[model samples]
Target: MVAKGKVGILTTNYYNPDGNRIIYGGAERYGLELTKLLLELEYEVAWWQVGTGWQKEMLPGVPLYSIPETGDNFQTCPRLNQSFYEQAVQVDFAIYFVTFLAYPQVLEKSISISHGIFWDYPSFDAVIPTEELRRERLRRLWLAFNGPRKIVSVDTATIQWATTTWPGLWHKFEYIPNFVDLNLFSPSEQERKDGKIRVLFPRRLTSVRGINEAARAAEILTKKYDNLEFHFVGRAHDDNLEKEMVRWSAKHPNIYYYWKAPQDMPHVYQNVDIVLIPSKSTEGTSLSCLEAMAAGCAVITSYVGGLPNLIIDDYNGLLIRPTAANLTAAIEELAFNHDLRKRLGQKAREVAANFGLEKWKRSWAKVIGEVFK
Candidate 1:
């Protein structure tokens, strides 16, 4: 069925479309894909970013719009002064990246998507928060999510967290995991040759994701074995982290950085033997993990968060503590043994086959379509 009204997606960061293609992490990917799905279903789609950044172009027929930044960028939340609240505003429904950024009563129908907890996982910090800030965040979260709209969590961890912490709001939340196109992400001919192995850090170059630590680990390993090369794909959300990555690449000939989107990550993953996801914080479910798995890369990730749920510690993939020593060891362990890497990757693909785009689309359509009813 064709959607009857325009749908707007509000995001925390001003997403640059033509620049990186897949700009933001999992949430942006979800929002972007959902926009495509809506357009396919004949809905008028409006892509709303908090500010007008580098995005001058949009996906063919979809027009992009910006919300006036309310002059408030408190930690991880974007507070817009006015959004979807004018006589000219034609969007009947809006899908928010997270509940905190949702415009109060701005759309005829509003659906909150719980991708990841921004406060819990700040783009800048690799450290713990102050108690005062934590309390303030909690207050804002209650103000945001303690409303009537249907909320969609990207994974089960989010539902469990919300139910335990927020209690009464459990009835409103829905679990919808991240997905990958199986056809788009699969194995390719091994790119490793001449005793050289490629290890890829696919997440944004953020300290929280352990880019610095990973770089240090890679540098140390390169000193021991010259054929060990490291490649980082995707741009940084944090400037310092980006600079650090560039500097590290300069310092270590074995480490390399791609400032822009490679655009085709499946090919990128397939070309590499290892995929690293050393996140300091939790995710509902990691899209990086799922995608890399589908591409048949030997997956190595932190034991924290939903990673343990996806990886079985050398069963399907390898899981380690998010530390330089641990991550370095995991990479080295997989690199030295080709058979283990192949076995883990094959099993990883088998596991990832369950999370395809078709399943995700049907579930998301049902949840979003429920809003109109």
Candidate 2:
């Protein structure tokens, strides 16, 4: 097939700019799938992201470039976007992997993505310390919103937030939830030989992801229940955080901490009996939650951001406020009730079928076709 046209994509970071290690996270996975979709649609693709001005290959032929521009107090990098816009002049279209990256100026044929609201937490107060700073940030975001032809929001909470913040811009958004590869994350047919109830926390070691709550719950529940085991299966932002988790896990019985590549996650998901997505804030319809549901694991997640979109309390999965006590109780209840576990897992898999990879591709293709044509 003849290539349609070249598309330049800009992001914050696809990988560590100084090294070859790829950042394994939900947003990175979304970017990968989006790039693959563009490739499947016969568009030549190149990527730009914040780094030490190095160049690498994202795939076989797709080039990934880096820019040295740094963000300011608002975390908006206009210089990076401007750099991308200027350097990608030969490209026919553009994609802002992050919404804020399109600020100040953007190409005519471009769109942006919103992973969800990142400013919902209390610590964001330090980022925008004054009213003037807050207003300036809003002004930049407003300009960013106007720059993109359409903003693809991964969850409804983002669209809701945008509309509430700036009421007249409802026409600028498209709702497309995150997706999962059902074939890869399917349930195990065989029963567990060890007869242990395993619970998985498949998220980064961050406070917003409720890692603290999860850790507290793990410490409490593992000590209380002999048959229960807790697994923490994701990386932290720094080596210190990783070391802390490793040391903490080492000190506790029935608690384990390890990280796995995105491709290797299917086996890990399939082996687990339960999944916890205890996000306190700043989330979308998470890939981990969807993959867990697809793997037929009974999921317990917090009612924050887009998590509620995936789970219904006592229906497909358990949705609750993210607290150490609440998580411990949920795990305890699931551990004691085998029938509830089986039912929730079965329903979760059934609900997860609606967000399959093919459907996601078709939805994205429609939007891309309309914008790029």
Which one is best on lDDT?
A: 2
Residue-level lDDT tens digits of model 2 in 1-373: 7799999999988887664667878998898899999999999999998888889988889999998876644768888888888999999999998899989898899899999888899888987999999999999999999898999998999899889999987899989999999889899998787979999999988999999999999989888888899999999887899999999999998999999878899999888899999999899999999999999999999888888788999999999888899998999999889999999999999999999999999989988998997
Off by over 4 Å in 1: 1-3, 16-24, 52-57, 73-81, 103-108, 121-136, 189-193, 238-244, 259-262
Question: What tens-digit string does per-residue lDDT give for candidate 1 at 1-50?
Answer: 65677877766554542234336676667766888888766787776665
Worst 10 residues of 1 by lDDT: 72-81
* Candidate 1, position 156, lDDT: 66
Count backbone clashes in candidate 2. Answer: 0
Error of 2 at 248 (Å): 1.9
TM-score of each: 0.87, 0.97
Candidate 2 accuracy as lDDT? 0.91
Worst 10 residues of 2 by lDDT: 69-78
